[model samples]
Target: MSASFIEAMTAAAAQRPNALLTVASDVRPCTTRLAEVVAAGQRMGTRMIAAGILPGDIIGCMLANWREWLVVAVAAAHAGAVMLPIVTIYGAKELGFILRQSGAKWLFTPDSFRNIDYSAVVAGCGELSGLERHIVTGPAFEALESEGAISQPVDVNPEDLALLVFTSGTTADPKGVMHSAQGLLAELETMRLMRGGSDDDAVISPWPPGHVAGALSMYRYLCQGSPLVLMDQWDAALAARLVEQYRVTSSSGTPFHLSGMLAAAEANGHDLSSLRQYLVGAAPVPASLIEACQRRGLAVYHCYGSSEHPTVTSGVVDDPLDKQLHTEGRAIIGSEMRFVDDDGNDVPAGEEGEICTRGPELFMGYLDPVLNEAAFLPGGWYRSGDIGRLDAEGFLLITDRKKDIIIRGGENISSKEVEAVLLGLDAVADAAVVATPDERMGEIVRACIVLSSGASLSLDDIRDHFSAAGIAKQKTPERLSIIDELPRNASGKVLKHALRNCS
Candidate 1:
């Protein structure tokens, strides 16, 4: 636990040189050895240091799920630089904010991923004062891989900032969350304790490498030397194929992802008996979906966590059916949770209040100093901004969310940010964004718009406007309703509850 990620990876690779780490993608599917990944990271890290990257420099990466992405992540840790992973879906608006806020010095991206042109996106950002170089992911990037590993080891502390991931919180702008090497390793250990696994287990991760869960999945292979199969993007049919082909044992995702995989397995008649445990979170989980997985001989359990604190509570496979179906499970080992009222007083045993937790896996703090005070309470407990209560048997059940955000297919979208974008449209006089229930995605953005006088708009028009604004498409409102005005209370604040009720 005292060693940094690179140190742990080096030790693990020395012990298991031939361990497998496979990446299954549309472009290429290659199974790499543990030694090969470590050597590549070392070579890349040596090149990075020679290129003038300091120990604490921020390196931004906006690549899709590829083996090269993992190599860059490892290389950042090797060179003692903090890795800031930008979601590939982010456009100029979000990307520019992150680069400017984090002050990233070096950026690594692909020439093109899917339909997005990295060169164009970078150019769209205009100017970045802190960015020293931009390296595209092709022969030029491959050339950065020096011929040999560095002879001297980099001195990295366990408590040093290793990762800076931007999360869409309840605010209009993204919050930069910092994590140390020790914190990430603690998260992996907590996960291991939560789920009992075997040495023969192989994991198929459909998560994008930018998200916190995806970042942790990649770290699992580096720290534990486990065989991991990475998917560049989420494709239910392809996920089923990878699971059957690789005999994958466990995975984690939202209920939406689980439903798709289950449907794909049923339609294709794929043998998915190897997949035993699926950790479902990041959105509301339905009891019916859990029952369906049970009928299919797959063990699906609910988990509770956020970017601030990863894996606070998790359900075990051996838990009773009633508990697994009804609750999000109890706090894992070394974690403490409690419910607090608005006044910060402890709620009664069976009452619902905001869920607060503190553990070794908690993030260090937000990059902006002003946000940290409101994010955490005294005694180092993080306010989850969620309403949940513990049952008599110590299981946590989430009742509602206090934060105004919509989670669509495991991605958190700030409703305020969406509303701000909607208000920028000339056709929109006023806007209020709320979450409407969705059968598949759990929740989606619904916009209640007050159009300007003598102006009109449609869903297609809103989508095109969002595209032109350089915002992520997922934040665009899926369902729209033009109204005379948004209902307001005495204080002139929009009554979001009324909008949700009507939606």
Candidate 2:
């Protein structure tokens, strides 16, 4: 295996010079052949060095999924600089926090994207102490590329820090999660082994470049020498067209992405026969959705992991449908998983408890030492803050998040259980269940729902639906609020804390 990302990318480019990294855009489609990608990356690396970027320096990038993003990412690795990918959806507040907290000296972003003037946003950032350079990607980047290429790539140790990705802060401020070059490369190797696909297979990546899923997909493409089709903005109809045009063979995203793709394909009569696998995660997944995708000849696999450690467990394409729908598969190679109680003692198999994991793919630690102290247990295991159970077959069934459960009166209710039942209904498009303040019961279950197109639902309707599903009465939502869309972070995870505060 390659020691660093630069080595892996250079080798892949040499083997497949003609392969392309295609960017799907509504304005215009763009592509960079492997040879050009390599050349540009080398040139940018040299420019970065000339600009006084040193090894171990953090360089922040807040750009969308485009050719420029890939070039800058590889260039950062080539320059031995640690990359900090900031989600494009972040506004000035989040941007300021990440930029200041990460101590990124140089930041690369587009002047404007999707009507957001990032240059203006950067200008408005107050008191970012370490940010000395703000480079825009269009014309400014071209001038930088005018510099000559470097003789060789910068030397970096395998264990050197490479990436600092922050978690989507739903309940609190985002925390930066660091990863070494060796750890991330090892993860790619494990993923390549588990999901075997040739260079000829085209993969569609709709995830934002800042998210770990998007970054990992880009690296996976380079590692496998596959053609990557990146979507700048997600539109289900446009995605369907791209999949048909590019013959996309594999993809990964949350259930929201899968659902949108299915609906678009069905409505537009797009042929999705070329799709071989769609790995779904990042939220509670409904079995009905998986069944629906399977009936349409799309292989839907459930995946489980977190920002701290990705791809802990993922269903295989060849697994039985029941397993795919019910479990998050077994522990991936190089990863160990265990269920534990609040005190960190291991829980017996088939018992519900918090999931703890230790793996080669795990992040080095949070940027804050205080946060790191609270993140791990006595062993090396990272507390996942998720509740789950391991079945006899070793498949993991994630029941709920540790903090997501609601206590109505004296009974505990899993919000995921109620949401799952709600999603199983034909009229519900999306749902998030959270605890609402109750005078008598202390806290009661309240559901924030997004109804299917042209469908309506009431509190009574939700109660009847839960009752029909045989869910416990306490778990049924006592109040329902129909909204146009559920509030979500960039990763497609519903912000339940936001829902809890909603009137």
Candidate 3:
């Protein structure tokens, strides 16, 4: 048998059957012990095979960060099925696109969450050509468990595809990034070395399960037999309470989450001293945020990565505050990173250029062949499309992004996607979306528009249009600016840098 995550998790459970696998919250709190988690996965894996989900078939999961999500993910691995995690916040448009693109054989979702009827969303998605079964959590899943389980196990290999992560790019549609079991395991090992926490530790993860960061957190903790406390919805006060109650030793999030937790802890007088490492990334880290977290006895470190390759670089927990605040730290083990010019030649250490990386932790490739060809160089290094430089000591400093995308609260929002939506409105002649500085979210979407003659559109009007178009709420522009004409260069391209400066 190959080095499957399911096999490793089963071994861990055998050694520490009483360890807590997850502390999940829904209407009430629930805990899943390691042994129970393993058994649940086994049962679910049998159900998956009985439902005709074969090895290497795609299984989609569109649920929150609950215990069922973890169980289903591991079950997919045990059944030798490819796991595809869909963001819960995705609307019908995004969800339908993913379901159709991935050709998922089965989908797992909740009946309802946060007052949104997910079943209705699925029903409204028109046609899911390849979806053979839809399983709801709660009572529906229990009914499946009531059926007899299979006695045999599925065979899997380390090089077999295991995960498909859809990440928003410069286009309106998301790109499906693939990963093998071996690659993901290599990444987990690197993360373990970079951010140390043992089985005795507990992790408080607020990131959505759809993102690579959240999935990595779940798998990494399971591999180490650590306990995970998940938050279905992000509330700083609730997170602070959970940290204190569970004595969470490690956590990860963007600057916004870290800042909110600090504010909540200060306001409510919650003790957060149990936190040893808080890996902060997904957006530019502010010096003030790191300083505040460190003062509150939280070890905040800047980390860098993407959907294609998670955890490329990160600061050590014991590193100086200056290094943690200024740079993204050295590359983690098993990762080879470099900065190159347009010709793919290596740039000087201190010069800014495109960041490229390749290693065991790198993802397999994009789902689209054309995208894969464009994303890699001749030497198999994945082009990051980010502008950065390495210091003399190999610490990376990200200067800018080659793609015009705004990251708000760790979610990648394509400026062009929003711009396309705005241009579809009759009241808009031309539109360009840019990132606006914000103290909390790192950056928010701002639209600079040239309205049609005698047409007046407010920010509310634009937002309503986006909502009507079924765009995710996070992609909507938070601010709008009306201008006679966009500043442009000789090539007729709007100067987005100038628009950013207007903020």
Candidate 4:
């Protein structure tokens, strides 16, 4: 067995080719193969560490989901180098910001993905002077893998940084998320309890490996020796087909992504009975989608957490439908969570406030000191920056992000709550509610909507649609912008911050 249990599975794969994670169409190791990946990482670690790159010096990687990527990642952790994962959608400027901020000395990027030249993106990054190595996926990444990497290992403790994850939260600038091996391992154990993993299980997912969810699946599935069926991109029809073809036991994606899958399955008549649980999160689930999933015998679990505090709140798969309809279920095992007021005092049950957490699952701390001190309570519980209320049963009902709440006439209106109302409207296909800058009433709730295709819906029609549904007049959208499409990130997340400039 390899040093890490996750690697033990990969080593097992070396002898048995049954374990797999491959992107469909043009199947080649972005690193050629796992053996090469392990070799390259070992070589780089020895060559780089001897040259003074510390165990935690961030090594950035941007690639599509490929099996060897995990091998290199495990190799980095074992070699004591911090893994710096960046989004694949980034241009040169954003890539440079991450590389520079993380103090990265090495970068692993694909030559091209869907024909976007990643080399061109990094070419524009500030300076290549600090970068000692630039390995491209196609041929270059494989070249390094062919020559055996240094076998020497470094001494690393559990508290050492294993990953440097970057995220912007609901509405903010991107911040570095440094996670120690111990904390991540704890979260993995929690996930195991939640997932009930097994070697016979077939898992399906489409989240890119650069993000937390994607990376977590890579290691988590490996620990139990499960085969991961991956989609290079989130195409609903293709996903449903893969589930049926792979005989997948579980599937996951963002709420919208899963909704798309359900829609495509309903439209194209794909058999998705293999999926026992439809894991989803990163946004609110509409009532229609919930019903649609429930009809398929696939239970939908809502996840409310972030990169800094991952998998904190999860709705159990067997939760009561009514409880699942209102709240995101209870906290996962091994975490302590509460709703706190503006003054950091814990609020009574059912009172809306920031969701604060204290547990071993949290990241080490944010990279910025000023930000770090402001982000957590003195007792070490990290403030989630999301406003929510815990029911008497300890189920968390999130109202809105603290910054996304609209204060109209001194009443805080959750845009997410209002969006749920808008989604219930028959004419509306999708909606996003935001607090627009207002000269009066502090801020007004405004909605941007995309109507159901072929449905000629007007602004007043939607307002009346909400009003007739018993939605409070004040809670109804004051102003509506009808757009053909909503601004979304690559992961199917509606970027409200991008919508802020729509007006």
TM-score of each: 0.98, 0.81, 0.97, 0.76
lDDT of 4 by residue, 1-503 (tens): 11343244345446534455545546442313334444455665555566566776778878667755665576566557888877776656457767777788778877877766777778767676668777887666555545544655676776767888876443324578888767877887787678774656778877777778887777655544457777666678988787887788886666657777777888888888978887667655667667777877888877776788877888877888877667787889888887788999988778898989877779899776667887899889999888988888888888877656565533335676677767877778988988776543446778888988777666687677765553445666777788889999899988988787787
Better of 3 and 4 by TM-score: 3
Instruction: Count clashes in each candidate, considering only residues at least 3 apart in sequence or on different chains.
Output: 0, 0, 0, 4
TM-score result, candidate 4 = 0.76
lDDT digits (tens) for residues 169-279 of candidate 3? 777788999999889888887777666656678888888989998888778656557777888888999898889988989898988898898889889999898988888
Best by lDDT: 1
**Predictions in order: lDDT:** 0.88, 0.80, 0.84, 0.71
What tens digits encode model 1's per-residue C-alpha lDDT throughout 258-314? Answer: 899889988998889999999888887888899988997889888888888878899
Report the CA-based lDDT of candidate 2 relative to the real structure: 0.80
Total clashes for model 4:
4
Instruction: Please identify model 1 stretches exceeding 4 Å from their true place.
Output: none
The per-prediction CA RMSD against the true structure, in angstroms, equals 1.2, 10.7, 1.6, 11.0
lDDT of 4: 0.71
lDDT of 2 by residue, 1-503 (tens): 44787888788888888787888775436877876777787788888888788999998988888777777877888888998998875666568878988999989988887877887677667888899889887788877655574647889887878999986332335688899878888888887787787768888987787878888887766655678888888888988888999899988876667778888988999988999899877655668889998887778888887668977998888989999988998889989988899888988778999998999999899988788777898777899888999888889998876666665532345676567778988899988889887644557888888889989888888778765543436667888888889989999998887888888
Which stretches in model 2 have alpha-carbon errors above 4 Å? 169-171, 404-503
